[model samples]
Target: MGFLMDLIGTLLRVNNLTYRYSSQDRNLLEKVSFTIGLKEKIGIVGPNGSGKSTLIKILVGELTDFEGNIEKPKCDLKIGYLPQDVSRDSDRILLEEVKAALPEVYKVEKNLRVLEKRLENDVDTEVLRDYGELLSKYETIEGFQLEEKIKKALSKLGFTKDDMKRNYNKLSGGEKTRVELAKILLEEPDLLILDEPTNHLDINSLEWLEEYLRRYKGTILVTSHDRYFLNKVVTSILELRDGKSTIYSGNYSFYIYERNLKEKQAWEKYEEQNRKIKKMEREAKRRKIWAKRKEKEKIGAKDKGFITHRAAKLAKRAKAVETRIKQMIEEEKVNKPAVEKQIRVKLETARHSGKIVLDVCELSKSFGDRILFNSLNFTIIRGKTIGIIGPNGSGKTTLIRILLGEIPADSGFIRWRTNIKIGYHAQEQENLNMENTILTEVKRENSDETFVRIVLGCLKFSQKRVYEKIKNISIGERVKVSLAKVLASQPDVLILDEPTNHLDVHVREALENALADYSGTIIVASHDRYLIKKLADEILEINGKETKYFPGSYSELKSKVEL
Candidate 1:
C-alpha cells in the first residue's frame, strides 16, 4: 500500500505552462508540463537561453504571470531554491549564515533555555508545563544535533574550519555560492531546486555533492551542464529544448540513448506520412486528368449521358481526394524536431616543430607568503595533450601565464622550441578587446573579412550578433570570439585555461573534437572531467608546492592520485 501510494502521489504538477516576453512574438516556453513525485531526483538540461532558468523561476513562484496551472502540496511544505547567481550578502560568519536557514529551530532552542532559567528560580506549575512542552518540541525536531549537521554539511562542501570563521559577506563569488549551497542543504526543504550547482565546485566538492544528493531526503530538481555529475546524482532527466520539456526515465546516459531513438522514430514517422500524402496527391491528379479527357471525349457522342455521368463521378472523386488532402494537412502535420547548433573549430598547426615543444625547469611562484608552485619541472612533447588539474587556488592560471611569458616566475626558466608560435585562451577571456565588435576581433587575427565572417558564423554567431561589441555579448559568445582568434593564429602550441567553463555541452564536445584532431601540442587546465578524460594523453596534477605528471587519462590518474 505504501509503494502504491508513493507511485500515485504527485508532489508537483504543471499544466500547459506557457511563457513569453512582452517584446517577443513567440513564446519562450510553449505548453510545457511535467510532474515530480516525492523524493524524485530530476536533472534539467538545455542549451543556453532555452528557458531552463525560466521554468525554474516559475516552479519557485518567482514568475506568477505565466500561463499555467501548478498544483503543489497542500500540507505543510518548504522549498529551497539556489539560483545560478548567488548574491545574498550578510556580515555573519559562514556558520551563522548556514544556521540562519533554520531560524525556527534556533528560536525553539532559545525559548527552551529561557524557560529552563525561569523555572530554576520560580517553581510555578504553568512555567514548568511550558518548559516541558518546549523540551518535547525541541527533541522532536532533533534540534540538539543542528550544530553537528551544519558543520558536517560545510565540511563536505569543501569548507575548512578557517572558512567557517570568515565573514560570509567578504568571501569570493565561488565561496559565497558554496556557503549558499551549504545553507540550502542544511535547510532540508521538501523540494530543493538547484541551478548549475556544480559551476564553481572542484572535483572533490563535486564528488561530495553528488554523494550528498544521493542521500538527500527531498525532491531534487537541478539544472547543470555537468554531464558526469548529472549521471551520478539524478535518477531521471528532464530535457528542455525548443520551448518544450521531455522527461526521460533514466540517468544522463540513458537519456542520450533514448533521445536518439526517439528522434529517429519521429523522423521515420514524418517520412512515412509524407510518402502517403504524396501518393494521395498523385492519385488525385490522375483522377482529375481522366475526368477532363472523358468530358472532352463525351462531347456530341451518341452515349453522351453515360460518358458525362462517368466523367462527373471521376471529377467528384478528385474533389473528394483534394478535401482529404486538406484534412490530412490540417490534422496530421508532423513537426520535425529541432536540431541544436554546433560550433565548428579548426586549430591550425605548424608544419614541423622540434620533438620537445616546451620545458619548464625549477619553476617557482609565490603571492605574498603563500607559494603556489615550487621547483615545478615538466616537459611537453610535440603532438601531446596534457591536462592540468588542481583545487581552485592552485595556480593553474599563474602557471599558464608563466609559460606564455606574460608573468615572470620567481625562480626558473621556460624554454620553447624554435619557431613554435603559441596560442593562449585565458580563463577570464581577458585577451579579448571588449570595445571591439566580434567581427573586428576575429579580423585582427586574419585580415580577410569574408573568412572572418564565415568563421564567426561557424562558431554559431548570427550575422547580427557578429556586429555586437564583445562587452555586450554573453560570456559564452565572448569565449567563442576569443577562440576564433586563437584558431586563426595557427600556432604550433595551444594553451587553454579553463576553456570549457561557460560553454554548453554541444560546444564543449565540438572543442574536444577539434583538439583531438589537431596535430599540435595542446595543454589545458579544466575541471571538466569528461573533457579531460577524452582529450588528455597525460595528466599534470598540481598541488601546492608540487607538480606530478601521470602518463594516462584523467580516470587513470584519479586511481593513481588522491584528487
Candidate 2:
C-alpha cells in the first residue's frame, strides 16, 4: 500500500495547456497534458522550433502567461534549471563557482565557527546544544566532504586542477557550460532540468554524466539531441510533435521502436475507418434511392393509401440510416498521420584524384605553452570516411584549419594530391555569412536560382524560408543551408567539424544516408556517436599530445578500447 501510494504521487502535472506567442496566429502548444511522477527520469525530444525549449521554460515557471493548470509539488520543491545557454560573467574561479552552489553548507560551517569561539570563553548548555544540532545537520548533508565532491565533479567534466584555478569569466563558452553543469550536479535539487546538457561534453565526460545521472536520487527532466546520451540517461521519452506531447514508457531506442509501430497502427486504423465509412455511406445512398422510388410510386398509384404507407416506411428507414451515418462521421473521424521531412544532400565530386587524398606527417600544434597535439601522423585515402574523436581542445579543428591553409601549423607537413577540391564545414559555422539570405548563400556557389531553390527544397527548406536571412533561422536550418552550399560546390574532399551538432534525429539520419552514398573522401570530427558509428570506415582517436588511428568502425574501436 505504501509503494502504491508513492507511485501515485505526482511530481508535476500539466492539464489542458494552451500557449501561443502574441505575435503568432496559431497556438504553439494546444491542450497538451502530461504528468511526471516522483524520481522519474524523462527526456524531451523534438525538431527545432517544436516548442521543446518553450515547454521547458513553462515547466520551470519562467513563463506563466499560458492557459493551463500546472500542479506542482505541495511541499517545498527545489528546482534547478540549466538553460541551453549559460551566462559566463562570474568573476569567481571554477572551483569557487561550484562551491558557491552549496551556500547552506557554508552558512552552517560559519555558524559552527562562531559557536566554537563562544565555547572557548563561556561553556553555556544552550550554546553547546545549538552547536551540536548544527553540526549534526551539517554532517547529514555531507558538508565535510564538499571539497571532495567539487573536485570529483570537475575532474569528471574534463577540467584539470589547473582549470579549477582559472577565472570562470576567462573560460570559453563550452568551458563555462561545463563548469555550470558541474555546479548543477553539486546542487542536486529536488527537480533537475537540463536543456542540451551534452552540448559541450566529450565522449568521456558524456559517459561520466550518464553514470552520474543513473545514480541521481531526484527527478530529472532533460532535453537533448544526443541519441546515445538519451539512451543512456533517460528511463522514459516525451516526444513533442504538432503541438502535442506523447509519452513513451522506455528509452530512446524503445521510443523509436514503439513510434514506428504506433505510426503503422494509426495508418491502418485510418484506412479501416475510411473503408467502413465508405460502406455505410453507400448503404445510406441506396436506402435514400429506394425511398425516392417508393414516393414516386405513391404519387402515381391507383390505390394511393397503401402506396403512401409503404413510402412513409421507406422514408423513415432512410432517415434512420442518414442519422446513423451523421453520428459515425462526427464521432469516428480519422486524421491523416504526420509525415517528417527528409534532408537530401548530394556532394558532387570532381574527377578522380590520386589514391592518397591527404597525408600528414609529424604534425604538431600548440597555443603558447599548451600543446593540443604533437607528433600526429595520419593518412586519408580516396573514397574513405574518417571520424575524428577526442575531447575538446584536442586539435581536431586546428588540424582541419591547418589542412585548409587557414591557420599556420606550429610544425607539420600536410600534402594533398592534385585535383583535390576541398569543402570545409567549420564547427562554429564561420563560413556562412549571417546577413545573407539562404538563397543568396546558395547562389554564391551556383548562379542558377531555380536549381538552387530545388536544392534547398530537397534539404527541406520551403520556398518562403529560402528568402529569409540566415541569421533569423534556427541553428538546424542554418546547418542545412551550409550543407546545401557545400554540396553545390562539388568538392572532391569534404572536411566537416561537428556536422550533426544542431540537427534533430531524423535530419541527422537523412544526412547519414547522404554521406553513406557519397563517392568521395570524407573527414569528419563529431561528438555524435551514432553518426560516427554509422558513417565512419576508420577512426582517428586524438588524445592530448598523441593521435592514433584505429582500423574499423567506431563501435569496433570502442569495444576494443573497453576491453
What are the RMSDs of all candidates, in order? 4.7, 5.1
Off by over 4 Å in 1: 1-8, 108-145, 272-330, 341-346, 449-454, 561-563
In Å, residue 74's CA in model 2 sits off its true spot by 2.1
Candidate 2, pairs of clashing residues: none
The local distance difference test score of model 2 is 0.85
Error of 2 at 459 (Å): 3.5
Instruction: Tell me the tens digit of each residue's lDDT in model 1 across 86-167.
Output: 7778988888788778888878987887888888899999999888888889888888798888888888777778887999
Q: Model 2 over residues 278-326: C-alpha lDDT tens digits?
A: 8877877787788788878877679988877877777788788778877
- In model 2, which range of ten residues has the least summed lDDT? 1-10
Candidate 1 — which pairs collide?
Answer: none
